[model samples]
Each structure stands twice: as structure tokens, then as C-alpha cells.
Target chain A: MNLSRRDALAALAATGVVAGGSVALADDGTDGNVDPADGVPENVIGDDTVAILAAVGSVVYPDATTGIDPFVETYVSGRLSDDPDHRRGVVDAAAELDATARDWFDAPVTELDRSTCDRLLRELGVDAVDPDPEGSLSGRVRFYIVNELLYAFYSSPTGGRLVGIENPVGYPGGTESYRRASMGEETEHGRE
Target chain B: MAGSDRTPAPPADVCIVGAGPAGAIVAARLAEAGHDVVVLDAGPRYEPENRERQLDAHLRPGMEGPWGTGGERDAYTSSGERHYPLNAARVKGIGGSTLHWQAMVMRLHERDFEMDSRHGVGADWPVDYADLRPYYAAAERELGVAGADDNPFAPPREKPFPLPAFPPSHSDSIFAEACEALGLPTHSVPNARNSEPTDDASACVGYGTCKPVCPSGAKYTAERHVARAETAGARVVDRAPVQRLVHDETAVDAAVYATPDGEQHRQEARAVVLACGGVENVRLLLLSASDAYPDGLANSSGLVGRYFMDHCFAGVGGRIDRPTRQNHVGFNTTECHALYDGTDPLAGVKLEFLNYAGPSPAIDALHADEWGDDLLDSLRDSYGTHLAVGGLVEQFPDADNRITLDRSTTDDHGNPVPDVEWSVGPETRRAIERANEVQRAILEELDADIDWIVGPDETGPAYHHMGTTRMGTDPGSSVVAPDCRAHDLDNLWIAGSSVFPTGGGMNPTLTIAALSCRLADRLDRWL
Candidate 1:
């Protein structure tokens, strides 16, 4: 059975023990912030920006009853513990996302309502994504998305419990064929 | 002066040389069956923090990246000084060629195994499809391939895939839709990367570097199998290059290693499995000169280096008008899966549309950067705009297109290195031309700016070299029996694509994996 995302998370939470330090959260099919590692950037994200990001992230991916899980908060927050690269990039994206929100609606991104944030995000998402065709933002967005999701997905308590993915047994593919001629008899052009 | 400390090692129950995909497979399987196994590879262990740089001679000059520094130290020069060359694409690492492969997996058609019976050109394998289906299933389970079990185009297998097809990249889905519009069916391309974390390794982060060592554990490598065997009591000696299979009439006595201290340690084995892959395996056999077989042990047929073959490559790409959601990480998308049955005008031509590995900066600097605005706009819009469709035409085995010993050249270890004199055959060249035509047609159908081009006739290296030591039914005509056992040597075995008596019109990864699995099962009874 295709186990509902909730049942999977609840089962893991009940166990209170899982691999990869999974932080239970949502899965809205968006490929952003998917890593479950504990390398999400913090401090770089000011208190106001962090709230805005959480709100926006939650709205973009709400904690539905049948959702894959939840927006792994503590997990994503931990990824930025000391991550210099993502820390630097998230601060800049937050500034730009906040600046764009202010220009659109006379308020900081964290202060703005969900609907207003959504509107501004839709309008500014184009710029935020592929921000600089020739500049380093191409690399920055990758860092931002991964760091933002590190806590959200990879490091979550339910992180290792992904859909259809598993710990491969033996050789994922079989071992290479035998090489040397064994002592067994060689049949009609076929010995095996 | 020789060091007084050096002494020959003891005999091993089974000595599987080279920890490449082929060798690792045999070793892992044999070890699984509770046999004593000693695995050796030329490369030392590598990690992302201390990864080896890979450089190809074909890369443009002044190219700076992790790949640029690959050939810096281990460069092997060709006659042309244009390239400060090294066969760095082929590594001495634990995983072997799979370390650098794109992980395109496909099963060879029935004709591939029995080419002579149908095509009347190559030799037919003694082991048929029925003998290999179970192993193919096992291999799929091991690699965690994300594909439809009902792939209508390729050869048939016993069961469905362990996982459903992964979500395609935006452009890949669009191109696939476009191909469907043009009366061509598309399916998920087989890849060894995880759609989800199925192993202890990290999931596949969309860094778009599947052709190199995957930073995350999402992709499967030999280390997994090596680890499994080692846990089950196997000895894996990394950084150990087996210079020669020191053997005689009875059995392989031992292997002479060229270690760091310029010393030779003869490690013996009751039986030896040569898993060094196409070029090096043949080179190793030829290098092993003895009283019985001067040309090479198991060279009774003189077919060791006769039928060299590789799939011819041609690439094509252009911009897609709509932004696709497929640009996400993981096994994002596959393009052009159903194009090789030797029936379509492009039959011998296998198509591989662009997956996630997007454009390179130098290539963009050369082609995309026309005007400032257009350049920036294209690059920005092209965060997923550029869609590439690559074609791999079936390369017929040419007797002359071979790898021979260049008595003069030597690697850092000072062994007489292998010299490859290879070129495309007529049928393959024609197939490439036809596949290019199909690509151009698809580009036109997609209705993107028809003028832009990436690489139409330009060729990439055939890192997937095959068919050097082809296995066949006849001892005089082929090198090995169907089970990959060499014809002349009673205790010598061959693995890898070299025994691919016939190269099919698909990526050789899945077929090689299946064949290896089959060999392992046979060895269960035979050993």
C-alpha cells in the first residue's frame, strides 16, 4: 500500500528512534529545501526574516492531514548552525525577498500577510530564481534551497523514511560476472 | 638494491583483480556464496573532501573546473600535443568505470546475445536471455533503478522494476511530450541514482554531476558491494595494481603487485577472475607472457583484441519556450528512451535527451552569449531552457579498431601501457547520421528557435568501450565461453564488456550488470 505521509510520520514519531536525524515535515512535491541534513543556516536569518521564511514556507507547503509530513522546523534551523555558504546566501535572498515585498506593499516580508506574501512571492519568484544568468546567484539559489530544506527534509526525524527509496541489499546491481575458468566442466559453449 | 623485508604473499582461494563494476560484481557474488575472496584495485579510496580531479583530452584548453585538474599529474600523452592527455576518465578507483558513468541502464535485446543466429555477423552467446533474466532482476534490486517495468521499447525482462519511474525534469517532460506528439513513445530512462534514500548514502542532490563521483550516496558505486563482501569476510586491497596474473598450466599461482615502495608482492590465488574491463583486461592478459601462451593465456583463439567496439555519440540541444518544473534535483528526467530496435530509420541510433546536467559555462560562453541582453536572458531563462538530445549509434565490432601495447610508452608505475587505435565503423557512422536527422526533426517539431545548435556531428569519447574479448560458442572464433570463462585457460575467467560479443544499441550498464549476475549464479554451481 502507498502509505499515507501522515501514518508514516506518526509511526516514526511513536518509535522516537529513526536514522539520519529526520525532522518530520511536509512534502508538496516542490524540489526546494529537500535535504534533511543539520546544516541549515541560522543567525544570518534575522528573527523577522526567519518568521517570514517559516510562514512563507509553511503556506507554500501547509501541514495538511494527508501531507507527506510537516515543515521540519528544528531540523531546517539546525542546518544553518554554522553553515557559512548557505548563511551568506539566505541573508541576501531574505533581504531581496523582504525588499521586494516592501516595494510591493509598504512592509517587511515577515510583517506582510500570507496572501500579500504569496502575491509578492509569485511576482518576485522569477527574479529570485535564476537571479543572475551570469552572476553567482545561479549558485546562490542552490545553496538557499538546499539549506532551507536541510532542516525541512534531510535532518527531520522522519527524514530517512522516504517514498519507495530503500537501503539496497547486497550489490544494488549484482556483482560482476566470474572471470577465471573454474575447475568445473565446460559444457557446450555454456558452463553455467 | 631490493629491500630485505619483501616476501611473496600466500595463495588466495579466489583472486578477483580490479575493483571496477565488473570485478566488484564477481567478487561480491562469490563472497556472498561464502567463498574466500581477495579483491584488488589500482586506485586508493577517494572521498568528496579529497576527490580526484578528472580531465579528458577532448575538453577545450584552459577549461577550469574539478575536471581540469584531473590530468595534471597522471597525464598520458598521445601523438598529438594538443591535449596534455591522461585517460583520467578511466580511474583506478574502487568503483572502477561506474565512478564516472552517467548511469544510463538498459538491457540488451535478444539479438545482442545471439547476434550470429539473426544478423549473421557476430558470434552467438552460449548463455541465452532465459539464463540471465533473474540476475537482471537482482542487479536492478541492487542498483535501485527508477524505471517502468513495462518499458515497451527495450528487450523484455522477467519482472517489474523495484520502483516506478522517477519524475522527469521540466524540459525532459516537454521533450518527451513533443516526441509523443511526433508518434514516438517515451519512458523513464534507467538510472542508478535513488529517487529516494534507499541506502545509508545521502540522496541524490541535483548537482548535475552524475558523470563523475556522486557527492551524495544517492548513486550506487562499487563501495557498497565491496563493503557487503568485506562484512562477509572478504579482503579488499585498494591501491594494489596486479601487474600480471602469475600463472602456469595448473592454476593462477599469484598476482605480482606494483606497490608504492617499488616492491613486488606475489599474492597467489587458486583461481583468478580478470575484471579489469575492456581495454585494460586485454592488455593485462597480453602482458602476462608464459610458456604455454606467449600471446596471452586464454588467447588460443587469437581473438583477444580482435573485435573492438564502442557506441558512436552525437549531441543536440536547443531552448524550450515554456519553463519546466523538471529542473529539480533527484533523478529529474530522461529523454528519448524508445529509439533503438534496428527498425526505425534511427533504429541503430539510440537517443538520450538532456537530463539534469545543464550547459557548461565555456560552451555557453561560446554559443549562448550572442548579444548581452539575449545572452543574459537566454542564460536566465535557460536555468532549464536548454534541452539536449544525444544519440548513441551502434558501433559494429571492427577487427582493426583495437588496443595494442605501445612498447615505448609507460605509466607512472613504469609498465608498458596500452595504446588504443580506434575509429568509427561505416555502419556506426551511418547510424549516427540517421540519429542526427531524427534529432533535427524533433527540434523542428518542438518549434524552439530552429537555428541554435549545440553539437550535431561532434563526438564524445566512448567511455563505455566494449567487445574486445568477445565470448562466443566456438573456441577458435571467440575468446571466452558463454559463462565468460576463457577458452584456452581451464581456470581463467573474463568479465566486463570485453565479453560483450555484440554491442547493442543501448547503454551497456544494465546488460553488463545482468551478465555479471548470471556469471555469479553459474559460479555457485561450477565453483
Candidate 2:
């Protein structure tokens, strides 16, 4: 399926299909060897919340699922642990998604299949509206849910590579590296 | 609000208010020179270890600004023609705005000093570039400026920059091609960040977030000076916002400040230096109105808060077919000061080739309608293929665009907050229009599809405040004298950009530091 080995292993390990092997977590480009699930605090958000976010992430980043579950879990937990007001917004968005899934398909978002979850997000008008946190139901869902998943994926080292951004904004990639032209550039002439 | 029931600290040789660059340098120099120095800051001291977390807050959407601004304590009213975002760039902490600044340290041009003589507009500085030459060298050394002598338009310098300049970023090469085609000169920008490791701080590590936070301590912040001042036995009292000055006609006897515990204290000193930025410096002076000086202290001319000025910015962004490799470097490396020393009747313009231009991959990914493969495609297509050029345009000082005390609005300590009445004059608007023309020309030369253009109407301040409490030789027209001493008070001196009689389309921090060192030297000789 043209998936990287890291993505395959992470997809396997997420469903308990693999065990005991260390998964290469989202490389912040600082420390790449640590396991994602090792140091996450207890119940940062909710197990269902993480599961629903991972499902949304698979749709947003269908081809770049390297450590999808643990990465999404870590990202959601870290995000929820920030400001209390932001945490409440995310939590409320998760509840609304779950309620919508139950009314549409007689199941929670976490219980639905990947395609069904994708369909649920599309039916909720998340694609049409602007991503505003304080907007209507579709807008809030897009902001707190869809955009959150996208941010997690693109900011991660593995996912950043898929979109040609190796080191995202916050990560420091030594000053010497920036002097060179990016890959696929013709001229290398920015030196003194 | 009587202050007789408050604690009073022992007298200091020099009392410097506001622990920003100006105050910190003054405190460090005075304390190191064997004088008792005291620095009072209205904000908390941010720990260095929290920088990475602050960068996280900066990266995340919908979070408070990474500089720790906002809340009731930092409130101010903008009763101006334009609603100035006062808190948008200010940091009240010990490091001050330098904590979140871009770290450029270009000196004001030689022509900037003689505006009245050269252009027959604005007040001429009491001290010229030659007078500040030695101190500019000293400030560059003190701040660890990394720069080259590549800028031919720069004023005469006695010494080379302390550290070597950073090479142009990869994106700069793209702008260089377009600029070279159009006969525009681009030179290395002098930055206050170190290119190599120093005794205390690390070198530039390219964290790509120099604006809100520099995780590696390469970029200079005023806290470093504050630390040096403390090491030299200077007393730095944080969370102490000075209410008013207890002064007679000749001198300021003491500064009455409020603490976090709701207790007021009178800190007496032989000399008081108001190092609090341009806005607050004027605000504090106006707030200290007494029967002797009913208008305000150091305000006998009634020009304490007059001549408010700020640099208005203009920007243009577009997408080139080839990869411009934007956002790889956080700060700009190449800038054009070619138009600054020109005969343009409007105002001098300094163009910057911005490295961190275009939408980031994460932002582009979120805005994409198609999820999955299409989102990644959209990011790869747009992220690296964009370039932008922006610059600061000079603003003429106007008496109407001033800062007065908002008696209706009060900060946390029940003191009247600063009411800014700022407006962009026609000269500034024309200058910004010219800057936009040059920027658009460069983008058009690149054969790029222009996405947006921010002209004079859409422009805002570069957050470089100046001109209020302006310096002059005459006592009747200005607030401070040649040596930054208040015209009305012998012992009261004003520091920072508030003393700039005419700002010259440049980042004012280097000039601020230079003037600060000069002020310190003057105090050292006097004491």
C-alpha cells in the first residue's frame, strides 16, 4: 500500500496486533527513540476521545499514519493539558461528535468503522464551513477536531516529511542546515 | 491612595525604573562602577527553562501570546484615530520587549540626526551620529551584535561588528535574484543574536521562532543585563509598578511604587532614570502631576506627551513556481536600506526580505478542503513555493498623535492607564505607499503570482514606539535635554526610545542601547 514500515507497525500495534516492540513515536527531531505511550499522564482526556481523534486523523492524513494511535493520544493529551478553556472546547467538540454518530448510525464515533467515521465527518458539513472555534456546530467540529488532527500530523516529524517540511516551526534544526537550499532546488547560491 | 503608611527602602545612588534594555544597561553599568543601583520592574522574571513551553504556546492555535501579555494589569485605552494594539508587542517582564523582539540592531543613519537641517522637518537630535559613534560601538559589543561591513549605506563605524554576520538564508537567494535584476541593494542585517557561543549564551540554533521566543539563548534579552546587574550587587525589585514621582520644582526626591501585596513603597535615590518605554515614560510623567507642575512633571513646556511617533509597515507576498524555501530561517538576513538615504520628501523606507513568509505547512494543511492525499499535495504545492518582502516606513511626529492619561480607565493599581492618540500622518502614508511599490516591483520581477498586498491603508505599526518625551537642546519645546535629563528636573533623566526626537525607519533597539550606554557614562562621571 506504499506505506512506510513505521506506519505499518504503528497501525498493527494500535489494534493490539503487535506487542512488546518499541514504536517509533512522532519525531520532534529532538528525541526520536522514546516510546509515545511510556510517559503520558493518566487520563489526560479520555480513551474514547483519543480513539475518535485517531479515526479523524486517518482521514486527514490517510497515507501518513506513523505511530497514529500513540501520536494522536500524545497530541490530544498534551493539547487538553494546556489552558482550561481550550480543554473544555475540545472536550465539548468530542462529545458533540459522539452524539452525532449515535444519532446517525446507532454507535459512538470510536465504535464506527474508518469509512463510516469519514462519512460521518463529511455529513456534518465540516468541509464546507470555515474552521472557527466559537462558530456553529460544523465550524467548532472542524476547528477543535479536524484542524487539531491536521496540526498533530503536520507538526510531527514523520508527517512533516510527507509534506516536504522536515522540521516544523517550533523544532530547532541547527543554523547550518538553513544555509543550504531545500531538496529539489536548482541553485545553491545563497552563501557569502 | 495616600502613601505615608508604606515601607520605604534605603536610598540608592541611582534608581532606574523599568528593567528593559535601557534600565538594565544603566543598572549594570552603575552597579559595576561602584554605585548602589536599584531597578524596579512592573512584571515577573520569566524563567529560561520555560522558553520551550512558551514556544509551544506560540505554535498552538488560539492560545494567549507567547510573551505573556493581557489581563487587567496590562490594560490601556487607544482613544486615537487608529486603534493601536498597545499590548500586541509589549512584554512587561524583566526582559521587556526584547524577550519577544526580532533582534535586529541596525543603527540610525547619519542623516537621521539632522532631520531639521537636511529635510527642514522634525526636530534635530541634540546629539548627532558622531557624538554617539563610540557608544554605538560599545552597545554593539555589549549586545554581541553579529554583522558585517557589507552595508555601504551605513554610517561611519570605528570598529567592525563584535561577531560575524549570519549568511543569507536560502530564501534570500530567491529575493536577491529578483532584487539584483531590479537594481536594489541587499545587505546583511545586524542582529543582536550571537553567531557563535559566548561566555554566557548559546549561538543561533535556528529554532524558527525568534519573534515570540528564542529557545536557545543566542538572541539578546535585557534579563541578561539584569542578571549582570544583580551579580554586581544591584537590587532588582520585580512586580513593583511605580505610581508617581515625589518631586519639587528642581528634582525628583523619590519614586512611589506599588507591590503585589497591595503595599506602596517610596524608593528614594540621588538620581532617577525613567527607562520605561516611550509610552509608559510619558504616561508616568503625566501621572505625576502636582500643584508645582499641574500639567505633569518635566512638563513645564506642556510637551511631555507630545510628538508621538511609530514606524508604519508595508508588506507584499506572492507565490513563485519554484521552491522559495520559506520559514526555514526565523529572522531576516538581507535588508535594503538603499532608499533610506534618498531625497524622498515623504519619509525614508527600509525594505526587509522576510524569510518567514507564506503560510506554514500545518496552517495550509488545516485550511485545505480535501483531506488525506490531497491535503498533503496542497501543502507541498504551497508551503515552499511562496516568498514575501516587507519593510518599515518612517513616520513624522505630530503633536496631536500623543499619549495622555485615560482618567476614565485605570490599571490594576488604580492608576490611570495610558490613553494613546496615535495617527498615521499623510507623509507616513505616502512613504508606506512607496515601500509597497518597491515591494510589489520585487515580487513582480520574480515572475510570481501576487497573492496579497498590504498597502498604507492595511499597514500597522512595527511596534517601535518613539518621539514622545522627545530630546532637544531648547527647554521650551522639548521634554528632555541633550543628555536625556528632564528639562524641568535636574535629577530626573529619561531613557529608551522616548528621547528619540525623530525616528529614522530603523529598528530602534540598537539606538536605544547606544543612548543607554551614553546615559550611563554621563551618570558615572556625575556620580
lDDT of 1 by residue, B1-527 (tens): 01223244356667888887777877888888988888777676555433312211111122243332233223333332122123744767677877667777777766667666766655567777777777788888877787775457766766777666665554565676678778777666777776666654655544334555455556777777777777777788766777888778645677787666777788777677888878778878888878878888678788787677777677666665654322223233454545566544333566776643354322232222132233334444444345567767676677776766666867666667776666665566666667767787787788765544333245554577688888877989888888888877766788788898778777887778777777777665677
Q: What is the lDDT of candidate 1?
A: 0.58
Poorest lDDT segment (10 consecutive residues) of candidate 1 chain B:
B52-61
TM-scores of chain A across the candidates, in order, are: 0.46, 0.67
The DockQ figures for the candidates are 0.02, 0.32
lDDT at residue B69 of model 2 (Cα atoms):
82
Q: Model 1 Cα RMSD, Å?
A: 13.6
**Candidate number achieving the greatest DockQ relative to the actual structure:** 2
Go through the candidates in order and give the clash count of each. 48, 0
TM-score of 2: 0.86
